[model samples]
Target chain A: MHLVGLQAENFRNFSTVQLSFAKHTNLITGSNGSGKSNLIELIYYALFSRSFKTSEDMNLLHWKESYLRTQIEFQRDGVDKTVVVSFNSNKEKKVLLNNIPEKFSVLFRESSVIVFSPSTSQLVKGLPSVRRKWLDRILVRVDREFTSILYSYQQTLRNRNALIKRKLIQKEDYDLYDLLTTNLVSLSSLIRKGRQDLIKMINAVISPTVSKMDLPMFSSIELKYYHSRMMEDPSLLAKEEIKRGGTLIGAHLDQIEIFHGDASVRDFSSEGEQKLISFCLKLCEFDLIQVKTKNSPVCLIDDLFSELDEDRAQLLFKYVSSVSQTIFTDLTGRLIEADKVIPLTREENTICLP
Target chain B: MYEFTPSYLKAVEELHQLPGIGPKSAEKLAASFLKMKQEDFHGFVEALQELREKVKQCSRCYNLAESELCLICSDPERDQTKLCVVEESKDLVAIEKTGAYNGLYHVLQGVLKPIEGIQSNKIRLKELFHRLQHESFQEIILATNFNYEGELTAMYIVKELKNSSLTISRLASGLPMGSDIEFADQLTLKNAFRGREKFSEEMI
Candidate 1:
């Protein structure tokens, strides 16, 4: 499914706005605080029902505005539908699909979108857990069955940690330790293999994309999945964990390593390079989902042009423009071309196509 | 250092014995008890006392109950011949939550924790054995936790019951009730598959 039109009401700097979209690419251009990124976030909220940058839905509401709303229109299976969401004083919200009330989760699988924000730069260089999350979220989205296993594994980790702490406080509580150790070993091992499989799939897509970007001649790009504890027995680790306040030897501590040639890219990669790697990795994920689900996702880019230098800018513009339905934002209006532009004019409280 | 009546001291002592509750919480609870209306404190004591006075472990299954036997065991509609053995009362509750197992259950009450002063005799094992003699059980499926103590307890029971003609089995582990093949840990899955027994008359 692809967005045919988007409207913003009292979100961030936009008081009210409406614009049409192209099936292939739609670029949104405006100045800083012109409500460009806010426009992209609005689209993301409609699709994923989540804010990428902040936890508070109030942040999504326009300043000094207690209520906000968004109306989005898209096409799925050759049928047109509309989804609307309104935020009120109690932070209560309602979702309507094609003018009919619908649950938010039901709206999820029908359409998918990959967001590239400044925060996403951390996917590559921030932490191993971050990269692993990048792996599982896509897997969970396309394959719902994986979500349970992922959740079970997480619960098992928490239970194990609680047992370890209890074991430490009461030296006689070896049974709890044994139980937690066995579980930590069994479930953590499973999570590791899951990560390895995802890493392999991600590499299949990232390898070419990284090669396409062609880093500096001396620089090399590598994405490695590392599971150090997978080789060690979980029970043995549990016995040793008594000394440690927490069990750090399982999937809880599992790290995926990213390298640029001989050096660790997490430490050495430039800011722009981190963004590029993360972008390519996510695009690889975008492709992986398409290959698995046979449906291309809607792509959303928030203030993408400002984050990318001219060289990287052209690459992002070229790539995002190729997606099924893409919406891009920028502080400067002259960047990538969109079939439609909804300018957040200073004079108007709402958005209107410029 | 202040003095307290026996009823007030009981509240402090009970609160202090609970997990994570410190002396501060115990003192707070005692003060709260004082702040409560006399009738309210009496009602709180009655409810707490009822939990201790009324709840009893089933003679057959070790499940907590308001009577001599647990509701599951006392319910005449349940199949007495099929006994599902679990490591603890908690496991029994977990199985009961599914509403899947309609047969009688034998809660070990504890596992074979040799280090914890709990031997096979410490739990309700002897009662379970006696129940087996009186009942014509066709099967005793082990539904223990998927952990070391659980597995060890299961193995001990299976070995002890090997001479009997009754069917003994373990829960399937390949995939949790609702899980996919894609996300399963490779090793856990491999072990699960390896542990899978052939479906046949004797095996069943």
Candidate 2:
């Protein structure tokens, strides 16, 4: 599957836009405030029916505009398809697939995209919850059951915590508490098993995959999934949880640690190493999605090439171009071997990408 | 503020207090009422007054009714030995429309959402237990929505009835007939995948 064209109206800084992409490497080059990131966000929003840049759809509207619309035309297995997304000031969102109004998941399930931005480095350098969310997003896309299980797990955690907070929970409430506890343990076990299998898959390919791409700085990566102290039996911590007035055990508290040879990447890796690791993880994610869905996801590389040194950037460009259709946004128009270049320049309210 | 008549504005305000009516919808509805004939207007008012004054919950099942026993409970043909428990009267009505279940129903009015301060006692669980103890029922079907809270409530009831000899079952969750696998939502698809049934020639 590949994106062929896009048409956006009253979206971000662009009042109207009609643009198309090459099937292979395409670079969107522009200076600051020229709607490079906005164009990327438009495609992401059209596919996912939500913005990756902002949580609110209102933020994507043009200045003083009442509505915003985007049309994304892509080719899947040599068959042309169109996805249109529109939002109004009333927070009403409408999605059309091939001109037929459909639910958001219809568009979401039709395609897969792997986005790599500078913020993706947070998966390694930030909190454990960020890493957990990253893992969960990939798992949900691959395993349909993971979404419901994870949702049930979170809800069970909240209900259990609420039960713990009840000051009048008598001895009779033990049955309810035990029910919640047993459910929590079983659900956590499922989640931890999914995360472990994914981590194992990534570790099995991280070194060989990056080495093949010639990015040796990240050729020795390993991911370790860690469960909380009470994985099998959360009831062991029931007393402490009640005393703390919240949950103290489950997948919500689980963590994943990344290693580079013998050093912990969370604490010891420099910014460059962290970013490289993030890039390598994105590559593994691309491969995993391809193997699972039998469709190569279009890669949205946002201003990531600019963050790397020129030597690394050149190597990464060669590797990225060989993978699949990739759209890279960069500040400088120095990617000489790109299949197409879109230079975006902005007037007051419109973006001209000629 | 717009110089609408006092009575019209008052009607609009009352309509706006309803669940889904906005200020504009309430105004439109009140204006439509102004366009009605005098007898129709009187009929509408009389119906609203009667609804407020006459409708009472069924004493046995907590369903909205005009008497102590709901129409279903008073009916002699319904399977009295089989009882279906639901979170609301509307669900029972939906099941009745299907003509698939010929049984009595007990409405709990709500489910157990302890996070929102809705405990088991907040609903009709005590009444349901009392009815179960005193009445003879061969089967009890928990027909709650298949969401997390619904499943939790069903589990709670099952745990409470651990020692009871009654046959307890829950509503089956899966894909609807004629559903396309590509467009199915996550939760429905998940339930369908989890509750997949074995295909047999005899069953077919």
Candidate 3:
């Protein structure tokens, strides 16, 4: 499934927009700060209900505005569908599918997207949690059980912690503990499996993308999970819990190390290299998800053109175009392929800007 | 700061504060209350107030019970030899719904989360292990929701119970990974039961 058109109102700086899309490649062009990133942010919000740039909802609703709204039109299996989503500080967010109220998950079923943005620079060079999260999100998209497991894991952690704080020693708490461990072991085993499979997938794609881009071989682009959990008694990690004041064992604390051959990429890589590594990972994601879901994701390559030089821009475009429908945004017209440009315009009063 | 009549408007304001209750829902609820006869409204208020006071946690299993022990714990016909442990009364309800396992139950008042400053000394771990020491149960079934924190809690209990003579086994493969038995489909629950396998004889 792919987003074919987008509409926005009081969403970030856009205030108003109605842009057409291309089947293979669509280019969004404008000056810097003229709502290019805002447009991409709107698409991300409409799809994921979160922003890559900012966590604060106030900033996204436009200055002094109380609400933000986005509407995206997508095509799936030859059927055109409309999904409208909006939120106000005063109310719960609302979603409508083709004018009918529907569950939020319904807004994204089988609808896949692979996105690359400046914030993604941290995927390779930042923290373990970032890479782990990147791993889980992709797995969750194709594997519903992973998402549910993660949700339960988070909630169980909260509930378990509450018991610890209250010092409430009811017999049932032990029973709960038993339940928690059994689930954690089973789910973590699966998560470990998914990651193992993902690492192999990443290994398979990263090299080819690097070769295709003609960039220096990133021997540093390696994903190494702290492999101790597989060997160490998970119970030992549990024993450490008394000292750590929580469950110190398993995937929650296990760190995944990334390297460019012998050098620690986290310390040695340039920001541009980090971006390249992250972009390569996103492409790897597209390949893996496509293989699993059998559908090319709607690719949203946001502002990568502004960050890369002409050579990198051409390479990035070349790679992104090989799979999926992509809508890329650029500040200067240079990023716009002469043959494929979709201008953003609003009539006198379609969706007025804040 | 906004002007409002005490009787009608205050109720509307308060009702609107509840989640999923927008201004329209708040107005509707308040209006529904007003439409109720005085006797009916009194009955509703009394029922709401006593909802928690009436039902209490079972002393044996921690499931909400009208009496000292819940139906599951109090049932003499149950196989005391098998114990299915869970994290909440909700989990107990889930297991009970299947009607496939005729066993006893123990509910952990909560799970273990150190980040929130929770410790094992606080929950029902000691009580559970203490019971296992005296009871000649054949097996302890770990049926907790599968997730990161739940796994830690489950492992700790299994480790503690390792000293006991009872067989320690986790509920099986078919419950669909990462979900609570409460949310598991009936087929999956049946499969989990059918797939039940021992963790290790050494633990027992």
Candidate 4:
């Protein structure tokens, strides 16, 4: 997949900007605070209809502006499609695919993107919740049934928690509890299996990439699934869950631990090593998405030059340029060899540097 | 605000109280009523008045009825050993229109919604349990909506009748008859896949 064009209005520091992209590699060079990251963010938002940086949509709006709008035109499977995302100060957001309104789930099924930003290191260093979310995002995109299964599991968990909170399970309520737990067990098993399968596929792609990178600290990186024991014996957990007055176990408590040799990368790896692992994981993500969807995803690398050392950056650029369409930002304005180069300047607002 | 007469404003206000009829729609309905012939207008009002005065809940199944028992419960040709439970009388009518079900019905009047302060006791579940105890049903079908509250209510009924020897089932949820699979929502498609039936060579 490749992005053909992007248009934005009142989005972050870019008041109004329209630009086309190359099918292979596009280098966005700009000074500090020149809205380079914002451009990449707009591309991400157009695909997902949500910002990766912040949960609040208002933060994407330009200062003194009440609304932000962005449109992205991309080609997938030899067909052109447009995605438009608009948000106002009232927190109302609208997403349109090919001028027709759509839910985020449907949009995600059609488009896929792998982002490597400054915060990408969080996958290795952040809490277990982050890794679980990452795994779920990828799994949901790859399998459509997984979305509904996950949704049902979440709803069942909420209802079960509510029932437990009542603390008065009537004779009749026992059956309800059993029904809910049965659903939770089955759904969690499906989710656990989906994540496990995704991790396996990702590991298959990532192991060689990590090894090929010749990073000594992470010569043998592995992605492992850590699930709650309740998945195997839900009945046992049910007894403890009633005493705890909440659900004691499920995929919600699961994690994806990244291991480097004998220890967790989060505990032992250096910052640069963590970043490299994250980069490898994203490359695996790009490959997995392509293999699953049969369409390569647009890769967005923000501040790539600053994020990696010269050798690592060159390796990443070489890999992405050969396999997928990539757009990366550089602040030094150094001429990076690419199919297209977009130089941005920051005055009161961002503009294309002549 | 004072452009219309008092009776016209009152008519509009009453029309607006109907579900899904906003203030603008209420005005439009009232204007259409005004444009109707005098006899037709009186007939419409009389029909509504008759509905309120004559329509009563079926004593046996709590469905809408004009007599002691609902039409389905009283029909001699309908299956007496099968009972289909629904959340509302409108659902009974919808099923009846499909011409697919010839079994009796028991309207719960509403689903069990604890969050909305609607407990099992608040609805007609007591009557349902009483009927279940007295009636010798071979099978009971839970035809509730495919939603969280409906599922909860159905589960509660199943639990209540756990000791009974009757076969119990739920309405199969799937894509509508004319909908394309590509257009069906994920939940609907998933349910359809879950409830799919195996085909046999003899049936073919």
Candidate 5:
């Protein structure tokens, strides 16, 4: 899939803007705080109807503006599709696909996007839940049933937690507790299986992708799946859960430990090694989405060049250029090659395609 | 804005109090009532008045009825041994329309939502426990909706009746009949997988 055009109104710092994109590569260059990130955010918002930068929709609205609106035209499977998203201070947000109101799930099913920004490195160094979320997001896109299983698992966890918090377990409550634990185990097993499969796929490419980048410090990389204790003696785990007054063993506690030989990457890797690993992980994500959906996702790289060295940046750009379409932001356009360059300024928000 | 008569405005406000009936829908309904014949409008008003005055909670099941017992509970053919518990009378009606269940029903009227200050004692749970203690049931089917609050309510009831000998089961959730696998959503598909039945050869 490739993005053809984008239009934004009263969104963030831009009052109104329109720009067409190239099928291969589009470069967005600007100084600090010139709405470069906001442009990528508009594209993300148009596809997902939510901003990646902030959870609050009102923050996307320009100051003194009542609402924010964005429209994106893209081509998928040789067919043109349009998506429009708008939100107001009243907190009413609407997403329309082809002029018809659509659910967020439908919007997600219709479009596949893989984003890499400065903060995405948290996937490598963040908490277990962060990795779980990243894995679940990709899994949901790869296997449609993964979303439902994840949702069911979450609902089961919430119910079980509420029951545990009540602090009064009657003789009769034992049956319900047993039933809830059974469900929790089953759901967690399913989610863990999905994550394990995804990690296997990611591991398959992480080494080669990193090796292709030719970073000398990194000889090999591996993603180790940390199975939850629930996969062990579930009855023992249940007893532990009851004693702890909360769930102790489930997918929520699982992790994907990245390792370089014997040392943990998150602990021993240098800053450059971490950045390269993060970029390789994103490339694996792009490849996985392509393999699962049979269509390359539109890549959005936000200020990635700033963190990488010249060689790494060139490697990243070369990989991104091989994809169907890539939209990236940089502080300067000197090192980046693009089919089109969009220069954003604070005063004039006008955008030209080429 | 065109001014409506005081009586029309009052009717619109009252209609707006109904669930999901916004002010615009209330005004439209009021206008439609005015356009009807006098006798028809009087009949509509009389029906509304009777709805509140005559409708009473069934003593046996707590479903809305005009007498001591609901139609389902009073029916002698229904299997008293198999009781289906539901959250509302609307759910009972939906299940009855399916012609798939021949068991009697007990309406809890609502579910347990502790965050909203609703507990087991807040609904008709006491009555349910009393009925279960006094009545002899072979199987109790929890037919609550497959949602957070509904599942919580069903699980709570199951806990309340854990010591009892009656077999308890929840309503099976899966893809609807005639739904194509390709078009079914992920949740439905997952449910279908969860509820899949083992196949055995009978005559094949």
Candidate 6:
């Protein structure tokens, strides 16, 4: 699937903007603060029904505007599809797929996108929790039942924590605590298994993608998952849990580590290595989503050219555009080989395709 | 700004206090009341008055009733040896509509929600245990909603009755009838797989 065109109204700094995209490569060029990234965000919001930058839907609205709307037209399997999303000040969200109303989650099933922004490097540079959450987010799209299992695990963990917080466990409460622990243990196992399988898939795709870019340093990259603790001795932690007034062992504290030839990337990798690994991980995500959903995902690259050298940037662009339709935001319009370029000027409310 | 009459405003306020009726809906309902015929309006008022005055909690099972016992509890046709426990009178009503259950019911009024300070004592668990001891029951079906608190309450009740001779069971939760298996959510599919019934048993 590929994005064909996009339009937005009263979103952030864009009062109104419309532009068409090419099937292979599209470069969005603009000076600083020219709403270049905003255009990418509009497409992302239309497909994902949420913004990667802002968690609050209210922030998407243009200043002095009470509502925001975005429409994206894409082609999948030789059929054109349109998705329209609108949000109002009342916190109401509505999505229309092919001109029919649908829930926000339908976007995930209908289309997929893998985003690589400057912050994507955090997967290698940030805390373990960041990597864990990223895994969960990707799994939610690839595996349908993963969301339910994760939700159940979190709920069971919270309830168990609340029970422990009561301090004094009554004689009759033993059975309830045991039951909660059993449920938590089983759900935790499901979650751990899901993460393990995802990492295996990522590991499989990461190697070929990494090699495609000819990054010999990352030829042996692997993603490893570390469970918080073995569920066998949950009883051993009961006392510690009661004292701490919360849970200590479960998927909630699981860690994910990315390694390059037995060396942890987060610990030993340079800034350039980290960025390239993040890019490869996103490419794996693109391949996984494409295989799982049977539709190629539109790759969204936001403000990432500046972080890498010009040579690596060109290679990244060539590989991504070849695999899937890619839309990249460039500061100086350096990648002049793109099939189409949409230039934006500061204070311009309209985008004319060139 | 134009102001409504004192009585009209009061009517709107009262209507707004009811569940699901917002200020705008309340104003519309109050205006509709003005257009109602005298006798029709009187009948509506009489019905509300009767509901408040006559409706009472069943002394036996805590289901809504107009007498000492709920209709189900007073009925001779219901199975006296089996009891189905629910979290509220509304849940009991829903089950009754199915006509699949011929047994009596016990409404707990609420579930155990420790996070919200709703402990065992806040609901009707004590009354349930008291009924179980006094009344001869062969089985008890815990029919709570399939949520965290409801499941916890059902498990707690089972633990309390661990030594009892009565057969205790929980409602089977999984895919809805006639739903396509492909469209079923993962959690429901997991449950359906776990609770798959034996074909031999069904054949018999």
Task: Report the number of the highest-DockQ candidate.
Answer: 2
Task: Give a tens-digit lDDT track for model 1, residues B1-204.
Answer: 777788878878989999999889998987987799999989998999999999888866788888888899889999877999887778888888989889999888777554454555677767877877788899888888776566657766665676889888888777675888887866568767898767899755
Could you tell me which 10 consecutive residues in candidate 1 chain B have the lowest summed lDDT? B112-121
Candidate 2 on A1-354: residue-level lDDT in tens? Answer: 899988889998889888888999888888888888887888899787888778988988999999998888999888899999999999999999999999875565688898878788888898999889889988888987887798899888888888889843664355667778779989999999999999999898898768755787777789988888774444556667778988787899998999988899989988988887877787788889888888888988888566666766676666766867888899886754678888887554554443
Tens digit of per-residue lDDT, candidate 6, span A1-354: 888888888988888877788889888888999988888888899887899888999988889899988998988889889999999999999999998999887687677788888888998898998888888888888888887788778777777777778853664345556777877888888988988999998998887888777786687999999888765565667878888888887787889999988899999998989988988887788778878878778888887578667777777777778879999899877654788888889978766552
The DockQ-based CAPRI class assigned to model 6 is acceptable
What is the Cα-based lDDT of residue A30 in candidate 1?
A: 60
Candidate 4 lDDT, tens digit per residue, A31-51?
A: 897888988888888788988
lDDT of each: 0.73, 0.84, 0.72, 0.84, 0.83, 0.85
Residue B147 displacement (Å), model 4: 4.6
Give all TM-scores, in the order shown. 0.66, 0.90, 0.70, 0.86, 0.86, 0.90
Which scores higher on TM-score, 1 or 5?
A: 5
Q: Which parts of model 3 have CA positions greater than 4 angstroms off?
A: A98-109, A156-186, A219-221, A228-244, A338-354, B1-204
Docking class of 2: medium
> Candidate 3: deviation at residue A299, Å?
2.2
lDDT of 1 by residue, A11-86 (tens): 7777777777878777666656566677788888866556777778878887788898888888876888888888
| lDDT (Cα, tens digit) per residue for candidate 5, span B1-204 | 889899989999999999999999999998898799999989988998999999999999999999999888899998889889999999999998999999888999998764454566668888988888888788999998888778768877877777889899998888887878998866777778998877869635
Each candidate's fnat, in order? 0.00, 0.44, 0.12, 0.20, 0.20, 0.40
Q: Give the 10-residue window scoring lowest on summed lDDT in candidate 5 chain B.
A: B113-122
lDDT of 5 by residue, A1-354 (tens): 999999888888888878899889999989998888988888999889988889999888888999988899999999999999989999998989999998777787888898888877887887877778888999888777787778778877776776666643554345455666777788888988899888888888776676767764554677888876644675676566667888776789888888998899899987867777887888888888998899999999898678678888788778867966989999888887798999988776555453
Q: Which model, 5 or 6, shows the larger TM-score?
A: 6
Report the C-alpha displacement of residue B135, candidate 4, in angstroms: 1.0
Please provide, for model 4 over B1-204, each residue's C-alpha lDDT reduced to its tens digit, 9 standing for 90 to 100: 449999999999999999999999999999999899999999999999999998998999999899988787889998989999999999999999999888899999998764444566679888988888898789999999878789878988887888999899999988887889998877788889999989978766
> What are the per-model DockQ values?
0.06, 0.50, 0.14, 0.33, 0.30, 0.47
Which wins on DockQ, candidate 3 or candidate 4? Answer: 4
- In model 6 chain A, the worst 10-residue window by lDDT is A167-176
